[model samples]
Target: MTTPGEGWKTPELRAAEAQVDARFKQAQDLANRLRDTPLPPVPPVDFAAIARQVERAAQERDAPEQLKALKRKVDAGEFTWEDVVSGKAAQDPDVQAMQQENVNKMKQAFQMLREGMAADEIMAAQDPRRHRDDGDENPPDVFTEDKW
Candidate 1:
């Protein structure tokens, strides 16, 4: 049987292998240091200060031109009672209750819309071509069949 080449046991090859092992050990030590090191605490966000800044900005802003552009629409009766009622201008208790009610209605509408879209995707997945079965029966109707 022929012996393996002498280069396999050469000084350079052995040095390269030792260098790789040393680099791996260094990487492990770095990882351990990072894992043990405590991260700096995050500073708290000042929402009240941000709100004051926003209020100040809005008060100082030159919005007359923007308001002037909308003045025509306001004068032309394009702005309806419902439009203003949905905004912050209507801040009474009754208006707040109405806003909450409208928000609930919108949430329900969006949830139904999402469920309908999901149902369509599920119905498409149930198509026979999507997966092959060993002559098994169709899957149960989730809507029609109730566990209760």
Candidate 2:
């Protein structure tokens, strides 16, 4: 009733082959699903915006170093909530100095803009993480892009 190699397979051998076929079919189905799956899109980075945010945070953290008089007064608790609430705190010499620094920085920025440079260009100039071209060789802004 059997033909060639089919006559040599015992019932146990036939059962094993059936199990192998079932597993192979399952594996193929899984591989097909994986091949058809779509990957998520990658988000683009705004390095200039990130640089601006970090610079702002650094300015706040550097207050103690920039405003020595302000730090001393703040540590001594000389100014009360009432002084701040009544707007007297704005008249402080240290606060005025800080305002002047901000004004000077803004002036320099405006001058750069008047020279036809973009805001992002100014930010990039100030960003230490940026790499520059030496006029002879072209380079990527971010050093991590060397592989490109």
Candidate 3:
């Protein structure tokens, strides 16, 4: 009956194994020493306070440029409460331009809808192959064909 260590009986191999064991023991001892060492105390964190500050900063950072400009104008007292209430503040060139753009987009969408309905009607009337029953035809069998 042969043993597992029978092939490792050589003196050179034994010496190599001893060296590896010694290095492993040294590494374990170092790890144990590090585990016993004292660490610096960590300051207590206020997570809720940090989260609130982060949210406020993000809201400020993510505000739109136009909104920021409006805020600046309001803060500078360029317009009175009556101007805002009476819709005079909305008469700013930028606001007017944006409203005009929205109106133009709505007009274009109505035009597209009208043109699309006309096109669909024309296609349905003219095209004979619009909705044919494809399942009526038999599919070609590759096994029966000799062209391959």
- Scored by TM-score, the top model is 2
Off by over 4 Å in 3: 1-4, 7-16, 61-148
Winner by lDDT between candidate 3 and candidate 2: 2
Clashes (N, CA, C under 3 Å) per candidate:
0, 0, 0
* lDDT, model 3, position 113: 67
Q: Could you give candidate 2's per-residue lDDT for residues 34-60 as a string of tens digits? A: 999998898876555654553354355
**Per-candidate TM vs. native?**
0.27, 0.37, 0.31
Looking at model 3, report the run of 10 residues with the lowest lDDT sum: 136-145
Instruction: Give the lDDT of residue 116 in candidate 3.
Output: 71
Pairs in clash, predicted candidate 1:
none
Q: Which is the winner by TM-score between candidate 1 and candidate 2?
A: 2
Off by over 4 Å in 2: 1-64, 80-87, 126-148
Candidate 1's C-alpha runs over 4 A off are 1-9, 45-148
The predictions' CA RMSDs to the true structure, in order, are 22.9, 22.5, 27.8
Best candidate according to lDDT? 2
User: By how many angstroms RMSD does model 3 differ from the true structure?
Assistant: 27.8
- Alpha-carbon lDDT, every model: 0.52, 0.63, 0.56
Per-residue lDDT value at 133 in model 3: 47
